[model samples]
Target: MGTAGLKALLHRVRYEVLPAKSTEDKVLAHVPRDVVVTVTASPVKGLEPTLDLTARLAAHGYRVVPHVPARLLRDDRHLKEVAGRLREAGVDDVFVPAGDADPPAGGFEGALPVLRRLSELGSPFARVGVTGYPESHPLIHDDVTIQAMWDKRAYATYIVSNLCFDPRVLGEWLARIRRRDVALPVHVGVAGPVQRTKLLAMATRIGVGESTRFLAKHPAWFARFAAPGGYAPERLLTRTQEALTAPSAGVAGLHVFTFNQIAETERWRRALLDRLGG
Candidate 1:
């Protein structure tokens, strides 16, 4: 991609933040109101933290998209309550994922049922997002994952890819999805500038550890992130530029996983923007 196209993608980038104690303050201090912010729902903390932080961020004038994972909800009643809360807060966008919750809280075991419930509730939000895996999921078969996307096409407005380090894999996945006829605009997920140590520490704090199921299910991610040498997000972006800018890619923008390193992420983004001529 040309510098102009790269800059445009960066400009449309959105940050995904964990709903932790200090997340609200860090986002308020470092993130511009013009930038979109997506709050994550933690299985450990449940959906309360996600909803609370989203309401607070929306109040501050940021376009907030909260993760409303199916596993966290109890039933249709819970879904309605969640929707009502977001509507009261003026939130119009949400990202729904199957989530890591084992023995799902209620009837919803995956995103599709919750999506159907949302439509039954008259599609409360303007934009609803579902997860897409560029690489094979450790637990789910690749065929099954893509078929879920096909099943969800009628309900979801967009797709957000899971974080994948390999640009070639990302590009290939984009092409494959187009071939499959799932045409929703995609927000390619990428990690922000994060220290491996900091990332591991955050994971532990959030109840993920070496022996945790989270790490076990994402062994590939662990190996890549913990490998020798620093991880430069810009390099990944540069390598993936052509695929993203391609006409058939249908890429909407980027969804940066900050791991709550808000200041560092924002600084890195701005410096990159400046280096690319603002």
Candidate 2:
């Protein structure tokens, strides 16, 4: 990709944040309003924190998206209330996830059910997103995950892939998605620039089994960050340039897993923007 293309991809990058205390304020206070901030849900607690953070962020005039975990919603009334609250807050988008709850707290089993129910309820959300895995999930078969995404395509407006370290795998998997006629605009997830120790800790806290698989998928990357140094988000971004800019990839842009390291990630992105001089 050329400088202009790369700039376009980086300029409007989306940042995903957790529902931790003071995290929303820190992000809103420091990061540019241009960056779209998405809030994540915690299975242990439920969707309360996510929605609370979303409403606050929206009130602050920031473009915010909250993760709506299906397992956390108790029933249709719950879903309706959630939708109403978000809509009243001027929130237009939401990302639905199957969730990591041990056992669902409600009738909804997974993202598919929630998506269907939302559509049936005449949901107020303008854009709905679902997850995609570039690598195999530790708990589910790779084929099954792909097919699940395809089945959910009718209800989803876009796809946000989980974090993956290997560029080759990300490229090949996305290319395959394009070939299969699953042409949803994909916001590929990549870890933001963060120190190795904190990065791994955050990865564990997020419970992305793929994070461990990422290291196994590329020992060299693991080795580089295993010691005292930091991991550069650019290393991964530079490697997968083709998958991002290629038309066949149907790539939308970045969905950075900042892991609440908003300042660090924003610095990296700003430097890159200056370097590109656009």
The prediction achieving the highest TM-score against the true structure is: 1
Q: Model 1, 1-278: lDDT tens per residue?
A: 56777788889889988877899999999999888999888677789888999999999999999999899899888999999999999999999999888778888999999999889889999999999999888789998999999999999999999888898999999999899999999999988988788777766564331123344468677666667664789988988889888878999999998878899999999999999994
Q: Could you tell me every candidate's TM-score relative to the true structure?
A: 0.95, 0.90
- Candidate 2 wrongly placed segments (more than 4 Å): 200-226
Which pairs clash inside model 2? none
**What does the lDDT read for residue 263 in candidate 2?**
87
Per-candidate Cα RMSD to the true structure, in Å, reads 2.2, 3.1
| Local lDDT at 8 for model 1 | 83
Clashing pairs in 1: none
